[model samples]
Structure formats: structure tokens, C-alpha cells
Target: MHDDAHAAGVTRAGAAFAARRAELRMTVQDVVDSGALSKSALVNFENGRTWPRDGNRDKLERLVGLEEGALTSLYEQGAGMSRQDQTEGLVRAGAAFAKRRDDLNITQVEVAEQKIMSVQALIAFEKGRSWPREMRRAELERLVRWPPGTLASLRNAAATPSPDLDGVSAEPPADPSTLMLDAVKLALTSALDKLKALPADDAPTFIAEARPVMASLRSLQALASRAVRANIGSVSAVQTLEDITACFEDLMGRVAAHPAASLGQKLYVARRKRHLNVQEVADILDMPATTVAAVEADEQELSDDYRERVEQLIRTLTFLKL
Candidate 1:
């Protein structure tokens, strides 16, 4: 899965590198000479063979001059030699990173020279197979800025287990709560806009990420609404979150209710939050011009081709300036 993501990111990097190479009109030999690395190594790198290394990064940077950027991160992550494991306590392979250092489990110093501490630890630690001590846990955690639950896991590697979506994204989620809200918002907006055209992959991915947030919001909403009914709290404190929950729910409903949106509408929502002209939208939906006009003006009842699309368009575009 991480490999899939790495592949996707590296695909982007390959394009970037090729574009830079073309822009500079520098051939394989130019990089070999400029980077002072082996010609075969340079060729292999350009041809997607060699992995990006810290030692070689400076030379590459000097050679390419980073027109927009190099694919260093993706390049390194993709390389088998630099393969990171269990990034930030998200164990790469459970057995691989559970190495014991004496009575305590710690091996960061051994791989301290590596760029990603968590990955290095997992790779080396997995090679050992034992639990780390509390102090070692704290040190490694602070050393890597691990997630909230990892301290306990480090203390008793026997207890805490990694979870799905744990290392799904290596980037620390800005906020778990915020992440959920944003995922829901993203799914809703994406669904409303892309509709059936939404990649089967993307829609599900968004929903999976956002489900936790949505569930949490619903639970909170229920609790708060009950609280309001119970008179356990004042209106001011819970009021803000309560209002936000309502808006979030309503937004989710609109998105889920109609899953088949048009390309124009989706692009519009993504860009200007404005609907295209009736004819353009009609082209997107493969509907009649008159149907589009009637749908847009709300004269026609929402139906198969236009039903969800028009309403979604209105929802996204009605208040938007563009």
C-alpha cells in the first residue's frame, strides 16, 4: 500500500525530472559529468534505476539547479535500500521492528545516520525482536515525535498494536478531528461534484478517511443534542460545535444523497464553486439543452440525467461568486 503511494508520487517525480531535463537540454552525460557520479549510475537514475541518496543529493541539486523541484523524497522512499518501516510507530512489519536492546527495546542510535528515525528503528529493531523500556520508549518517541498512543506501546510492545490508517499517511494528520471533518467535507464536495465520474478508487478512499470523523461528529451531535435536552450545559459552550455539527451533517446528506454528478459541475465546485452554463452542463450529462435549461431554472422536476446534478450544482454554485 505504501509502495502504491510511493509509486504514484514517484510517477509524478519522473515527469518532473524528464521535464527538467528537457528544459535544460542536458543529456545523461551532462548529469554524469556535473554530478561526478558514475555514468551508469546517472543513466540508471534517469532511467528510474538508482535510488536517491543524501550523499548524491547535493550533486543532483547542483546539476539540476531545481527548476521547480527534484523528486528526491519519492525517489528515496521508492528505493528498496532506503525502504522505511513503521513510520512514526506505525510498525512496518510487526516482527521486524520489535527488537530488544538489552531488557529495553531501542536501536535508533544504530541507524541514527538514517534520515527517517522511525523507519530506521523499525528496520533494525525488527531485526532484533524484543520490547523497549519506558525511558527508551520516551527517548525514541521524543526523538521521532511519535503519535499519542505510542508511549504506552513502547513501554509494553506486547500491549499496544498498530492500526489501519495508522501509516496510511506518513504525514502527521494536522488534527485527527480536523482530519475527519476535512475528509467528510472533501468526500461530500467530491461526491457532489464528480458523481459517477469520480474514480471508484477516490470516492471510497475519501469515505474511508472521513468515516471516523463523521461517526465522531454524529456521536458528538447526539450527545450535545441530548445535553441540550437534558439541561446539563449552557447554550454558549456547546453552541458553536452544535451549529458546526448541523452544517456538517447537512453537507454530508447533500453529497451522499446524489452520488452521480457531472464533470463540469465537479470542476466547477472544485474551482469556482460555480455551475457552468446550461448547454455546457447538458453536454456533460448527455441531456437535452431544454432539459438542462428547465433543470437549471427549477422548472423541470429533478430526474435521472439531471436530478442530482442540478441540485448539487445549485448547492455548490448558488452562493459562490464565480
Candidate 2:
């Protein structure tokens, strides 16, 4: 059955590709001879025997004069037909996990910091873009207070067929806006918590800690703004984020007046003022990007050896009026 569904999806996507190629008056040899795509891959793609990788898809799209992701989107739609049941199962599991997390007021950042998984991974899982491994799934279930095997059971039930369907109402999946809102709220709450916990008497330490929190606030603000523009988010959420950002800015302003900020803080502020990303700075300093991030975040102590290098970098930034 799975093979049949897979073939159907492949055929649908392949037919579309073939039609487009034909419409363009292009032949298989014509595409292959261009050196952009291999003959075997192109043949398999057009013969409904395989799907194209991202790079191959892009090459083909450009060669055939199709818009970026045009073929990929169609292919996904065709392929999605086969995963409808599994998709439904993941959606249900994700919803359950989200509800439990919300109920506990646990933030995604907290979960990530605990080494359960990354924020991106958590978002993807919660949005049903993918599933976690067995161990990670178990960890998530435990973290959310779900009984052992609860997630497995939900997924299993979704994949299995049901009979005598009477009075069983399916819950609608959460929309994108709702999910984005949840993310904004959780991230905002986490940032606020960090702000509240910042040391009062330690100027350098405060600035170092607050810098990352400030970055998070700005990101959340941007996210909320985009959602509002899309007409899928509430203005009040944006307002709240803006208000928090203003307050945070005021606090950072007062802290900036202090003269005892650390070298790391100075580097961080200068880097941001110049609009240079971590990788850019890393390239300039010939240091690993992760090292730069750690230094800025105060997660790693800057060695004395890097002190001269950091001082020179700051001097350069100052010369640039950063």
C-alpha cells in the first residue's frame, strides 16, 4: 500500500515536470548536455522513479524557467498524499505536547537549555514538521508529565484505522498564527525572567547577561510585527512586545552609563553597533564563530591570549565609529 502511494506521488510530480519540460521545447538530452543536471537523475525524476534533491531541483527549475521552489512545492503536495495519516498522528501528538507545556508554563528556551533539544528542533516538532527520535520523544513525554508511551500510543492510534465511527469529533489543528503567538509569548516570558534575575550591583556581569536577552527581545518584536502584518496576529501582542522593548532599552541605557562594563561587553556592543554578525567577526579575528558567541554571551571565559586580539578588534571598531 505504501509503495502504491509513493508511486502515485512520484508519478504526479514527474508528470508535472515532464509537462513543463515539454512545454519549454526541451528534451532530456538538452537538459543533461547543459551540465547542470545528470542524465540518470533527470531520467529518474521524469520517469516517476525518484524525487530530486534540493540542488537538482533548483538547477532544473532555472534550466526550465520555473520559479524557485515551484516544482518542489508541487512535489511536496504530491508526496504529502502518502503521509496524510502519519501527518495527522504527528499533529495530534504535537498538539498534546504543546497543551501540556502551556499548562506548566514551561518555556521552549528552558527546555532547550536543559539539553532536551534545540529551540529550532522543538519548534519543528511542535509544528509537526518532523518527529523526534525515541529517546528525545521519551524525554519530552517525561518533561511534559505525560505517562510513558503516551506519545507512542497517540501516534499508533493515528496510524491505525478505526471502526464504528460514531460521535467522534476530531479537533482542528492549530493554525500558524496561534503557534507563532505561543512562541512569542514563551520567548518573551523567558527574556523577562532573565531580565529579572540580572545582578543589580554587578555592572559588567549585568551587561554581558543582558546583551543576549536584548537580542532575544528584538527578535521576538520582529516576529510579532511580521505576524501582525500578515493579519494573523493581534496588535496587542505587538504592543506588549514593544512596551517591553522600550523598558528594556531604558534599563540598558542606564547600564550603559556605567563605566565598568567588561571587555566582552564592549566587544559585543561594538559588534552589534557595526551590524556585524558572529561569523563575520569570527572571520575577521580568525576565531571560531562558536568561540565568539561564547565570549559575547559570557558562557566562556576569554583567555588572556585572546585579550590582545579582542582589544585590537575593539580599536578597529572604534576607528570605524562603531
Cα RMSD for candidates in order? 21.5, 22.2
Instruction: Residues 1-322, candidate 1: write the lDDT tens digits.
Output: 4665555334334434543443333434345534446766654454444455656755665444452234564344333222233242224223423433322545555434332245554555454443343223333443444432243333223222347665588665564444434433443343334333433433645443333334334334433444454444555425644564655445444434335533332333332233355557657656555444333222345555456665565566555664
Query: After best superposition, candidate 1 residue 88: deviation in angstroms?
Result: 32
All candidates: TM-score: 0.22, 0.35
State the TM-score for model 2. 0.35
Query: Which has the greatest lDDT?
Result: 2
Each prediction's Cα lDDT score? 0.43, 0.65
Off by over 4 Å in 1: 67-70, 73-322
Off by over 4 Å in 2: 1-169, 182-260
lDDT of model 2 at residue 55? Answer: 84
Model 2 weakest 10-residue run by lDDT: 155-164
Q: How many residue pairs clash in each candidate?
A: 11, 0
The best candidate in terms of TM-score: 2
